[model samples]
Target: MSELVEIREDAPGGPAARALFDEYIELVRERLSLPADFEPPEHIFASADVFTGDGAAWLVIFDAAGEPIGCGGLRVLEPALGEIKRMFVSARARRGGHGRRLLRELERRAAAAGMERVRLLTTVVLHEACVLYATEGYREIDRIQPPAGPPEIWLEKPLYS
Candidate 1:
């Protein structure tokens, strides 16, 4: 069955927001085959705070019944560049275009906020995510080696192009 998905902007610290983020982390850890005791880096967790500031936005996608099924955030990294962070759709919500919808919405909001480009990073293990980003016009730029955690593939897309 097709479910109606609605994206709503919200504070990253809300209870529902925290729950969705926690779920996203667990899914990523499992998909990447991380150790059972692996913990996400502090910087990654702290980055959520930036979404609560100016030129930034946090979005939660809700199902028709008002249940959150996905979440993402856009943060202005520089004068005209924004970054997509913490983007995820629940397992049950996959392959239904919800992810693409969330991504497009984020990009629209970014453009409306005067952003000229958007960048994001994901691990090589997230094959589906990598493919989605690539198919959506994001080009791989470089590999980022975080202080702690697996290396990440960086991708960027021009908003106006």
Candidate 2:
């Protein structure tokens, strides 16, 4: 049966939100092939401060059973600009359009808050995510080669036409 999913705006540190964040961390570690003992940095973990600034928002999507299926956060990076972060869909709940829905809601929230554009960071290792961003109208704006790990790509989308 197709699951009924609902996206809710909530703080990153909330119970359900935290669970999704934990899952996302593990998935990222695996996708990036990091050591098992690696602990996520403060910015990558459940840091409420990151989503508390101007035009910022956090959203969690849950299935009909009330289990978190996906999550993402938007934070203002500068005037008229916002950044999307921590986007994830649980491995069990993917391919159900949850990621697209979560991303649309985040962009809607940003636009409603007067943001002119939104940007996100991703690496090639997250193939599905990069594809999703591309299909959602995001375009590669910049790329950076870190001292270690895969190169990072920054994508941007204008909130309005």
Instruction: Pick the TM-score winner.
Output: 2
Cα lDDT tens digits for candidate 2, 4-120: 998988778888777877787687789888887777665434367788866888888989998888889998888799889889898899888999989999999899999899999
For model 2, state the Cα shift of residue 134 in Å: 0.2
Write one digit per residue (lDDT tens) for candidate 1, span 1-161: 27787889977888768878778778777877777676667545446678866779999989998888888889888979999988888887888888889999999989988899999988887777888898999998999887655788889999973
TM-score of each: 0.89, 0.91
Question: How much does candidate 1 score in TM-score?
Answer: 0.89
* Ten-residue stretch with the least lDDT total in model 2: 40-49
The CA lDDT of each predicted structure is 0.83, 0.85
Candidate 1 clashing pairs? Answer: none
TM-score of 2: 0.91
RMSD of every prediction? 2.2, 2.0
